[model samples]
Target: MRIKRPVKVFLLGMVAIVLLWVIHSYHFQNQQFQTDRASTYSELPVAATKVVKHAFGEVTIPVKPQRIIVLNDISLLDPVLSLGIKPIGTVSYLPQYDFLFRGVTNAEAAGIEIVGIGNQPILEKVLLLKPDVILMREYQRSLYQQLSAIAPTVVIDLPSLNYSFKENLRFIAQVLGETEKAEQVIAQYYERVKQLQQLMGERLKKIEVSVINVFTDGIIATYSDNETYNQVLQDIGIPLIPALAKQKETSLFLNIEVLNKYDADILFVMSESKNAALSFSQNPLLSTLKAAKNHRVYTVQQDRWWTYGFLGVNKLLDDLFKYLT
Candidate 1:
């Protein structure tokens, strides 16, 4: 059968439109690339530089680096942002929990270019950003030569020493000459923790809470006492389910049959994607959980909760106060 002339004409128009869009996008990106190449390279103005020993080696960095690039997670980005310094570029956060931290944070918000999707960096884009200092975890040492060629790259550990914000922030702040600010941030964070304790009072000791992560790969695990938001929860004085608290490993994976053993007065479920968690919850055994039956199970996006940052931790506290209180 011969196609109708009007429908065929419309289809052809749509195809032409799509083709033009693709061409336009290609040219736009190409032009931007060229523009980036033409831009002036950023350099610190002969400022006082201090030598900080890191994973790679000693790196002499600017006393105050203006165009900062964080190649790792908020472990570094948090200190920078919390200390009132904005980085020029950074890797994207998992699941984008911007909604939960809208007004309270600018962690990965406007004015910050996502130079990488996850842990992978787009070197060209990073080079174009013209960072004065490039910060990354020890795992990213392979890119040290390439990235350092663009700027003074500092290789630091993500947790540094077991996910303590004090040590991590103090070190990064010292690197940036913002140690004073780091102290203030640290004090304030703990102050909030103290406030949480006082706010909840005796009620905190009685409750048994558990935070579990449902991965897209079908791996279900609970937070160890000091992993992820567990530390924060521990600080808030919420007694995690006895079984979860006793585990020495970072991630405690519970079998389906043992769901009853990991019972909690409050269960917080977070995941990489909504579906991963939804699928996990489909198991009939979950219905056996006290929290499940009592309707104390709260599901949330594993964005800031999974991130190691002051702002993220603060947001996690907000969730606890919202849910528990």
Candidate 2:
């Protein structure tokens, strides 16, 4: 067991170096472990158990979403709020559409920040929130890659551009994990429709209904038979005029001459804006129509028609039915 002094000293140095290396490695490993935990906690803001697929592809719906960023579609806010979840941030639209925004007070009370996400939403602003989930519409797929990089994104498909209320509500319900809620809402809506159907069933069955949207310049636009307005009317047992049904199923703009061409028992006019309303109401050309002469013409605001929200649709339908009756 006897060793030279030089060998003893050299061995001691070797042992010291190994001990130092071990300590450094331990600290480094501990720091890295903490960093990893922080990364998980920070980036993923919710306790999620499942991922759901929607019309906009797939998203991981958190067990409870805490920081939801509604990018551009404020219309979807009502359903989320109805499910008892409040969004942290939402985009700002015109005041006329405030009926669709449900979580404004909760967001304000939470000190939630609202950045200018733009009409299309901004990627940098979205990334800053570190959102748990983002909701948009199917038409905004162009931002998919950029949004996905920041957080889970879900896009709900509307009933259609031509407008289908049933499909819009169904898809939105699927995205919110509220297929049952959606069903319930739809069921209630159908019940109302059935009542209206009974009331106007025989009358509408005999007479055709027509909806025309008029702009400031006397341009007349009519809804396709597939549009949500038409769907609602049809569900209530009303039928569209043959000419409108035969026309292409899209948002169509025609001249004032369309009034002479399509003879409808009831005509609903949609004003594109305030100015359009002023012009359409006073147009000498429109005075010749039976609807205009009998003062059966009704003007609907464009914002309510453009937004596809559950509550919004119900309100619009209620108003329409009340007027019709």
Q: Which candidate is the best by lDDT?
A: 1
Error of 2 at 89 (Å): 3.2
Instruction: For residues 22-94, write the lDDT of model 1, one tens digit per residue.
Output: 9999999999988776673443334678788887788878778888998766577766787788888877654
Estimated TM-score for each candidate: 0.78, 0.73
Q: What does the lDDT come to for candidate 1?
A: 0.77
- Per-residue lDDT tens digits for candidate 2, residues 1-325, read 8999999999999999999999999999999999999998899854654677777666777755567877653356545554455667666554443332332333322544554433457567778878887887677789877888788888766544335655665665565566787788778888888777777656766777778777766688776777656767777877788888787756777887667766567777767567887887787777877777777777775544544555556666776777677
Instruction: Note the residue pairs that clash in candidate 1.
Output: none
The TM-score between candidate 1 and the true structure equals 0.78
Using TM-score as the measure, which candidate wins? 1
Model 2 TM-score, all chains together: 0.73
Clashing pairs in 2: 117-121, 163-228
**C-alpha lDDT of all candidate models, in order:** 0.77, 0.67
Task: Report the lDDT of model 2 for residue 301.
Answer: 58
Error of 1 at 125 (Å): 1.7
Off by over 4 Å in 2: 1-46, 55-57, 78-85, 92-118, 159-163
